[model samples]
Target: VIRGFSNSRNPEKTIRAYIQMLKTGFSPDHMTYPFLLKSLSRLLNRKLGGCLHSSVVKTGFVWDLFICNSLLHMYGTFRDRASARKLFDEMPFKNLVSWNSILDGYAKCGDVVSARQVFDDMNERDVVSWSSMVDGYVKSGEYNEALEIFDQMMSVSSSKANEVTMVSVLCACAHLGALNRGKKVHRYILDEHLPLTVILQTSLIDMYAKCGSIGDAWGVFCRASVKESDVLMWNAMIGGLASHGFIRESLQLFHKMQESEIDPDEITFLCLLAACSHGGLVKEAWHLFASLKESRAEPTSEHYACMVDVLSRAGLVKDAYDFISEMPIKPSGSMLGALLNGCINHGNLELAETVGKKLIELQPHNDGRYVGLANVYAINKRFGAARSMREAMEKKGVKKIAGHSIIELDGTPHRFIAHDKTHFDSEKIYALLHLLGTWMDLNVNNDDSDDYHCVCS
Candidate 1:
């Protein structure tokens, strides 16, 4: 009965069964602990897991490899890496599962250095080991490192890359906008005849869309089997179209999605709101915002932020301000920043000052707020106040974050900062820029000829 309860999907029943077993004076055996540990992990009941650990030690099952591994996994799931590692070190004999569990614990805790150390120390590795390392790097925003590891896995590792590995690689490609590499992965998938699972197809669409290949994204969406396609696939395509400025197409897709039996989730509305903001559909945005409640989905900060952007961009700054004032949740920095930007654009200095003060209070350490406020003051010829804002930022020790841009070339991402000359081809790049500047000056001179003639006449 305890085994049945533990193996069942319901965690509450599992805990209740354990309680009943305890009341009946039935001490659980070694075989019983793994499934119970799994239930504790699923429930995220760390306190209960600790109690179970104590009981396991009392019963002399702590040395049991299966029980220890399960305990390690549970601690990892709880983000208690120290405890997991302690258990790992105490093990008399370690297997592949034991090593993988500890490595996963470190990875899940964002301890990439420790995970790498474990990976390097491992005598033998399976596909899971490689996938964990790659996925860890991907999660930690080390896309380049993740790709490099994947290359090593392909060239050196005997274990073949699986769907999990492909998913993480595709996610990295999407984030880096590495269309060249993403396309290569897609081609590899085709060459291998790997099943186009829902997740794989969704990631493919997202990768293409984010990489600015809307056409390829659409192709993948169209080719997906209807039976296999789900709401996430539809959301990805809609979001892709909207982000690429095909707002009308995105709206049409949203309507089609509504016609389907699948109900829209928060993400669907987020995409719809983004489409409305980009298309400047003020009326449509309001309607969609109202429809979110009808769908029984609460408005998240991102949803509100999008609405604020839509209103602000439409020159409805006052209305947006009122909306923020009446929001059930407190306004986030991005929402206020959007309104502040609109004020700067529309030359509404008064509202700009108001929003600027709120923004500073909310994000006192953010250098962008001070800079933006200074720009607003300068635009209004309030030179003293603008200088004061900068002085205040310096006093507060807030340094402006240097802006940078990324461009992918030949499947590698290159990052550049303003006035930076660190690239190997900096001299050649500067030469090309100088030539472009001369060409621009020549065009300006040509356009000024008519003005010169009028002055002479």
Candidate 2:
């Protein structure tokens, strides 16, 4: 009964069954403790789990591999890496599951370096070990590292890359915008005859969309839709189309999803709202927001922010401000930032300054916030105010972060930052820029048309 309850949703019932068994004088042996430990892990009741650990020790089941592994998993879930590592070191013998649990603990904590150390130290590894490490790197935003590890896994490990591995690798590809590499991964999936599970489909759509291969994304979406479509797949397709400026297609897909009786989730609405924002479709945005309100999905802060962006982008900065003022919850940094952007774009300097201060206050450490406000003032020729803003930022020890851009060329990413001189040909690059600037000045001024000579920059 304990095992049955534990395997199902209700950990509380699992505990009750265990208590009832104890009252009936049934001692928990090796067979029973693993389930009980699983229950505690699900409940995340550290107090209860600790007490049960003591009881297990007293009951002489501490040496049981299954129970110990369950304990390790429980600790890993708790993100108590130190405690989990201590327990791992104390174990007389460990198995594959044991090592994976400890490695996952480090991964969950975003300590991918430690996870790699553990990975290197492993005598043997399976898909789980490789997937955990790859996923850790992905979660930590170490996209290059994730891909490097995946390459090593493919070259060395006989264990097949599972759905989890593909998802993580595809996520890495998406972040890097490595279209060529993403295509390779897609081909690999096809060659391996990997099942296009819902999650894998979502990752594929997301990868193609972010890599600017919206046509490919649409193709995948269309193919996936031939089967009984899930909400996640629908959400991914909608978001992909929406982000790529295919507002009409995204809306059509939403309607198609509704026709299939597939309910939209929060992310679904967010994607649609983003689509509307991109197209500056104010009426469409409001309609979707109204629908979101009528449906079971409560509007979150991100939704509110997206609405603000929609209004702002359409030159309704004041309306966006009023809408934020009427929100049930306090405006988030992003919510206010959208309003500030709108104010700046619409030339409402007074409101821009006010919203900018609020945004900076909400996110003091956000370098962009300080820079945004200062740039607004500088653009408006409010030199004193702009200088003051910069001074205040310096006073607060908030250094403006150097802005950078990355472009992937021939499957390699090149990053350029402000004042960066790290590249081997940086000197030549700066010389070319100087030549271009001189050419632009002479040609732009010598233009016959007066309008052509009136350059804003």
Candidate 3:
């Protein structure tokens, strides 16, 4: 009953059942501890978790690999990496699970360097080990490294990548836009006839969408076995099309999703909302926004922001303002900023000032809000107000965050900033930029508009 309640996500009920068990003199065993530990970890009751840890230690079963692994996982989940590492170092008999536990700990804690060291030292590695390393690389935003490791895993042994490994690698590919690598993975799946679980299919759809291969994403969606077309699959397809500006196809798929009798979730609404925004379908956006409640999915602030963006961009300024005013949750600075930016874009200076005031009031110390407000004023030729905003920013001691852009070169991230000279090839890069600018000025000036000049910096 305790485990059932816990698995059902009813923590309070689980605690009650556990208390009844304890009062009946039913001592909890090791198996009982993992569930309780997870429940406590989920609740972030670190105090009670600490007491449970000491109790596990007192039971003299600390050497038990299962118990120790659970403890390590609990500590890591609770952000107690130091304690997890201490327990890992003191463990007497270490198995693959034990090693993987600590590796996962490091990965979840964002210590990918240490995770790589442990991975390199492991005498044997199974699917779990590879998944952990790949996940670590992905979490650290080292997408290329993750794909390289996936390649290395395939080369070192023909053990075959599992679902977990594929998911992580695909996620990295999605982030990095490694379309060629992703295609290779797709071919491997086809050749190996890897089992196509709903998750794998969903990941493939996501990967292709991110790689700018919506056609391929559609292929995956079409080939998904009938059972695989769940709400998640529908969301992935809708989002893939929506992201790529395929409004007609996306809506068609959305209607098909409805016909399939699969209920939409918050992600589905988010994707459709994005589609509406991209296609400038204001009426459709409002309909989907209203449908969210019927789907039993409450709109998040982000959803409201998207709606506001759609309405504002379509020149429904008053409606957007009313919507934000009536939002159940507090509007974030970004939410109001979107409306302000739209006002600037469409020359609605009065509403922009209102949004600017609200944003600065909410996030007084945030330089971006000041910058946005100033930009709006500058757009309207209100130099005095823009100058005042800048001066107020200076008086508040708020510094503008450095502007930088990261581009990957040969699988390594290279960062460049305004007037940055810290890189080894900074001079060479500047010279190249100058040459490219001159070439474009001479060769392409007549063909392209001044809009291309925005990237000069």
Candidate 4:
């Protein structure tokens, strides 16, 4: 009965059964502690876990390998890394599972430094050991570190990288825009004949698309479509094509998706609307936007933002403003900012001023809003208003943040900012830029002269 309740899906019942066994004078042995600890962990019952830990010590099961591992895992799951470490250190005989469990505990607590320390201390590591560290780095937004660990795993480990490792590595490559590295992983998958699970396939498609290889993305999509008809896969393909400005292909896929049994979700509509906006298909955008209601998906602020972008880009500033006014959800700063940008592009100073004021109120700490509005005033020759805006920002202690760009060269990422000379090859880079500028000037002058001669003739 105790084991049955412990193995049950419900943690509450497990605890009750344990209590009932204790009341009936039945003492739980080492075999019983793992399940109870797991139940406590699942229920996030730290107090009960503590009580159980005391019982384990009293019953002389403190050194039981399985029980200690369970206790370590429970503490890790609760994010109590200090207690986990104390337990780990006190253990007389440490096994591979003990090392991996503590590593996972530190990683789960967002302490990658400690996790890496644990990882480096391991004399012999397996797939779980490597995967935990890689996944930890990825979750912490240290994509470069994750990629480096994956490289190390590939070079040293005899154990094969599984689907989970591949997915995490692909995500890192996607964010870095490391097309060369992404392609290498793709080739590795093919060479190894790894089964293309839905998640692995989706990650591959997304990685190829984000890395600027639309053709490869489409090929993966086609291959996956033949065996798997999941909506997420279709969404990835549609979003990828839309982002790359392949609106016709994106729309065709959307139509094809509708023909299949897979239903469209909110993300699918967002991609469709974005495609229409990029392609300047105002009519098609409106149709797709309205179709959201029929598909039983409520329009989120993101969906409304996409519509505003579509209308604003089409030079319909007034219509975009009216749409925002009627939206069920409050317009976010990004939504208003999109409309403000459109107003600036179309020289609609009146709407720009209105939207800019609302945006500033919504995001007062954002220095870009003040700067953008000040620029608008300066463009319209309202020098006094522009000066006041800048002064206001200064008084509020808001400052413009420096902008930077990242470029990946030969699988290595380089970052550049205005006036940045940190790169070793800065001189050569600047000289190349000057030569490119000179060439562009010559071509522009020649084109103007030819146009002038043609008009006179």
Write the number of the candidate with greater lDDT, choosing between 1 and 2. Answer: 1
On a 0 to 100 scale, what is the lDDT of residue 262 in model 2?
Answer: 90
Q: List the candidates' TM-scores in order.
A: 0.95, 0.92, 0.83, 0.84
Q: Which ranges of candidate 3 are over 4 A from the true structure?
A: 1-52, 120-123, 155-159, 394-457
Q: What would the per-residue lDDT of candidate 1 be over residues 94-165, giving only the tens digit for each residue?
A: 999999999988888888899999999999999999999999999899999999999999999999888888
Which lDDT tens digits does candidate 3 get at residues 132-193? 99999999988878988887888896568888888898898788776777887878887988
Clashing pairs in 3: none
RMSD (Å) per prediction: 4.9, 4.3, 4.7, 5.4
lDDT of model 2 at position 26: 91
After aligning candidate 2 to the native by TM-score, how far in Å is the CA of 389 from where it should be? 1.5
Task: Give the winner by TM-score.
Answer: 1
lDDT of 4 at 10: 80
Model 4: which residue pairs collide?
A: none
The alpha-carbon lDDT assigned to residue 382 of candidate 3 equals 90
- When summed lDDT is taken over every stretch of 10 residues in candidate 3, the lowest stretch is 448-457
| Least well predicted 10-residue stretch by lDDT in candidate 4 | 448-457
For each of the candidates, give the backbone clash count.
Answer: 0, 0, 0, 0
